[model samples]
Target: MRVLMVSWEYPPVIVGGLGRHVHHLAIDLAGMGHEVTVITRRPSGTDSLTHPTTDERSDGVRVIAVAEDPHEFRFGTDMMSWTLAMGHSFVRAGLRVLAGDQETAWVPDVVHAHDWLVAHPAITLAEFFDVPLVATIHATEAGRHSGWVSGSTNRQVHSVEWWLANEADALITCSESMRDEVNRLFGPEEIQVIHNGIDVDTWPFAPRPQTAGPAELLFAGRLEYEKGVQDLLAALPRVRRTHPGTTLTIAGTGTQLDWLMETARKHKVTRSVRFVGALDHNALVAAMQRCAAIVLPSRYEPFGIVALEAAATGIPLVVSTAGGLGEAVDDGMSGFTFQPADVAGIATAIRKTLDDPAAAAVRARRARDRLTEDFSWREVAERTEGVYLAAKRRVRHAYGRPTIIERPLPERDPGK
Candidate 1:
């Protein structure tokens, strides 16, 4: 099947998990023999309205970067104008692709959009090309702000999300919790729960070298309010009372860094906490390798990919019972789950693992086995392909016929 993926972010221009998710999914789809084309916004400082640059990866996926106008966007107006501009750019690129030589003039069987950022363009292109549309709701504006669309910008985003869910032929979410949320909020007709996957071989699994000090606890992700990093910091003092040699390492950068540091100071655990800002891929893997255990204390996590990555690295995980973090890991068999914002519970879970390294290692091994057995890119791509086929069938049935494009292809040599 030929697929066109629309996203606002991609690698080297990622602000969150959406870009990484799209990158891995697209590559795996290509590997599965599907002709995948990705359309995304180019990074800042690039020329607006410049010709889109198309790069074909060795995995057979073609990525087309369309420049976005940086100066014309502000807070509340950003999403609207951005989507309009991106939709225009995508339409232009689609025309160019359709105008190419016979061998290169390919049309997509399905147009898949990730999140609300690209919803407008995805809907427009699907209608223009007369194909099926699939939209993946990674998270909702209401979910992110705890069911409160506080400001004008957030309300606008929420409206767009609702429109996208209603417009798509089928909806896809990363977890059951997300599916329920989408159903309650937007009421999509059909929704599929496809968990996010990771590459198991990406992280090295060798035992971390021992250093002469406390057992290091790692919390890697955005240091935001919803992430519950502050709660993790608050739990550190309690954890230290039980295991004085234990330390907490907070990685990732966000708006709450300063407040988190202040919280640590207030808790008087500043000495026991180390705030290492953002980490690249290699550094993140290395940190996972060395940490005694990985803790994700999220107040609201639609789907915790970090927990999956940690489990893949053979690290014992202690995640909060927020959205999908609890679903990602077994309570006791694989790892422990504590209630979100429960400082005592978080500390107790961490303390138990620190006290019994053998038990923790056993659980980590189980988690790793589960990750390898169940969560893999191959399985994810196969399931995603199934969703695409299902959506296509639905569209065909609705229209009472198969989609056909009668445009002329440019004449050129077949073996160009």
Candidate 2:
């Protein structure tokens, strides 16, 4: 299969799990003998003149990156316009690839879109090439806000997500919980659940040594309200009451950094809390090796891929049973799980993980064992391949793919 993947974030510009998810999946798919191509943006600060737009990775994936337009538009303040510009860049790069030498012209059998961010280009490429568009709704705007689309930007993003979900030939999500959320919020339809994967070998099992001073608890991923890091902060004082030397190291960065710092000061746990901001993946893995346990207190996680990475490294996990996290860590069986945003519950789970060394080690072992069967990239790619085939079958039944459709946008109520 000649698979063309569309994602806003990719290697060297990873903001979250979506970039890593696409990175691993594409490489694995190519390893399995599929011709994989990824269209993404050049790293944040550089342009095409500074960085090579076409990267032929040794892992058998061809990456064609685009430079943001030389405009005075900031993504934060001008998202709609920024997204349009990015989409235009992606389409241009894709068309260049498709319109190469007649003898070496490249064509993709399917266009797989990562999230709503790349929906415009994915839909355009799929339609222009007459191929199936398989979209993965990583998360939804409504889901992030706990079923509320309040701001104008929120509503705009939600509408685009709906358009992508409805327009795609087949839909996929990172978890069963997310599949339900997508169907409920968008429209009733079948959406495949493919949990985000990790490279188990890259994350070798590194059991923490017993010679510890303060009990170190690490929280990875972006620092945001929906991430429930604040809840973790709320539970810290309670955790320290029993384990006085317990320290919480907050990794990653987001809009809530200042607020989270203030919250720690408010809780009087500032001395014990360390804000290390964002670190590269290698550094994060090394810190994972040193920490007592990886804590992910996500209030609305579609699927906690970081937890899987922690599990793969044989690190004990204390996560919340929000969305796919419940499936990722099987409570007592694989690390520990508490309800989302449960302050008291968060304290208890951490205590439980620290209270028993033998039990936690056993659970960590169980998690590591589950990696091959559950979270391996090989398994994820195979499952994704199945989805591609299913999407193609759906398109075939719909009277085949059309090379071109010069139809105008249908009139509809935006509020609906």
Candidate 1 local lDDT, 13-127, one digit each (tens): 7878888888899999998889999887677546554633555454577887776544665424465765667667767766676536678777889999999978877887888
Which pairs clash inside model 1? none
Question: TM-score of the candidate numbered 1?
Answer: 0.89
Highest TM-score: which candidate? 2
Return the TM-score for each candidate structure: 0.89, 0.92
- Model 2 C-alpha lDDT per residue in residues 292-398, reported as the tens digit of each score: 88899998999988888888777799999999999888889988899997999999999999988778888999988987688788989999999887776244333
Against the unseen true structure, what C-alpha lDDT does each candidate score? 0.81, 0.85
Candidate 2 TM-score, true structure as reference: 0.92
lDDT of 1 at 377: 81
Clash pairs for candidate 2: none
- Clash tally for model 2: 0
